[model samples]
Target: MAQITLRYIPFKTDVAFLQIKQTEVSGIPLYIIFFYIHVYSAIFVLLAGFTQFNSYLLKKRPTIHRNIGRLYVFTILFFSAPSGLFIGVFANGGFYSQISFVTLSILWFYFTLKGFTSIKNQNITQHKAFMMRSFALTFSAITLRLWKIILVNLFHPAPMDVYQIIAWLGWLPNLIIIEYYLYKQSKK
Candidate 1:
């Protein structure tokens, strides 16, 4: 993921993913801005979020957990989620994919916010649950691209067509799996 992201470094317009998005880059003035914001801030989210789940770090180094957790929460709230919504509005695959991405941004923001508030209120269980939900959505960035590749290879569908399917498929299943795990954990 970091490798995929690093291709955009120094911020050139005619590069990597931007090569395919020329239409959006030229047409929508804010598209490039939001796209860059989403791309840059997402790396931080992935890094901080990964550390936040380390049991050893959480137990023996709670201060580290809280610090990285703050990075995850604030980055999502201030940068990632908002920029995601902006780009999602003009996403490929038309309204279907647009709606899916937009919904994802909203849920991602809501879950992360709830997680942060839960911890602030000293509700560890709720914090865990909400952060789980938030991270599930965060993982969608990778899953969405993976789904696109798989769909393209298997069905040879148009790029936008595959994107429409993946926009929902990517995050929904992740959230479902996490929810199931959370459910079973609660039962235990």
Candidate 2:
């Protein structure tokens, strides 16, 4: 993920994914700004998320876990989610894709915030459930791209069709898996 994100460094608006978003970059006055904000802040969120699920960190270095968890939650709430929500409005693939992205941003914010508040309230079970859901959503950042590659390789669908599909595919399966896991945990 870091490797993928590095492309945006020494930023240029005409590179990689932005190459396709030129129309948005040109027309949606704040699109470029929010795009960069989402791009930059998302790395931190992903990195913070990577550290948060380590059992060793949680057991032996809880302070580190807590700090990183806070970083993940706060960054999502303040930076990534808002920027995502903004950019999602002008998301590629038109209205349905826009709805999917916007819904994703809103749900991401809700789950992350719920996890944070649950932890603060010392509701460990609730926190774990919500954080699992939150992390699944975070994982969408990777899954989205991976799905795009696989779909393009195997099926060669139109770019916008792929975009529209991935807008939901990116996160839906992750959320479902997490929900299923949570249900099993509850059963136990």
Candidate 3:
């Protein structure tokens, strides 16, 4: 009995490992390409935002801030959100994952548009609020990848399962952070 159980254990482990390997290998090249694009765009947006924000905080350089901010928002709105949304549709797992991606895409557009509109109307406070929200979604690519790593390590779930959790896992924390930031801003 003991020998049988041990034998099965290794078999199960090997099967699981094979499953992961198979999925990773067979997944489309487009999937990998989109994944890379999503991650790089997030990094680009974050770096641009950090640079402009730091300049504003230290030197109060409005011109530099405005120029970088334009580039930042453009990246988020035009490049990041669309690619994310496309990738979200192709996201593995199932319908809930798809819904999460769709929701994320809408929120991305909404907050970004709000920020742009607020800026046009000279509403700095609102602009900041919306920009924070937009940035939160932009950061989701990073969060999603991190969550996938964690979930897979912990549960060794299937690729679809990981993808589903990642669909929600990626952006949910970002939204929470945005709420916290907005709350802090309001407190001040």
The true-versus-predicted C-alpha distance at residue 80 of model 3, in Å, is: 2.1
TM-score for all predictions?
0.97, 0.97, 0.73
Error of 3 at 119 (Å): 1.3
* Local lDDT at 24 for model 2: 91
Instruction: Put down candidate 3 lDDT per residue, 121-146, tens digits, no spaces.
Output: 99988998888788787777567777
Clashing pairs in 1: none
Cα deviation of 6, candidate 1, in Å: 1.2
Candidate 2's residue-wise lDDT over 132-161, tens digit each? 899898889999999999999999999999
Q: How do these models rank on lDDT, best leading? A: 1, 2, 3
Candidate 1 ranges with C-alpha deviation above 4 Å: none
Q: After superposition, how far is residue 26 of candidate 3 from its true place, in Å?
A: 12
Q: How far is candidate 3 from the true structure (C-alpha RMSD, Å)?
A: 10.2
Candidate lDDT values, in order? 0.94, 0.92, 0.72
Better of 2 and 3 by lDDT: 2
The lDDT of model 2 is 0.92
Q: Give lDDT tens digits, candidate 1, residues 1-188.
A: 89878999989888998888899999988889999999999999988988888999999999999999998999999999999999999888899999999999999999999999999999999999999999999999889889888898899998888878999999999999999999999999
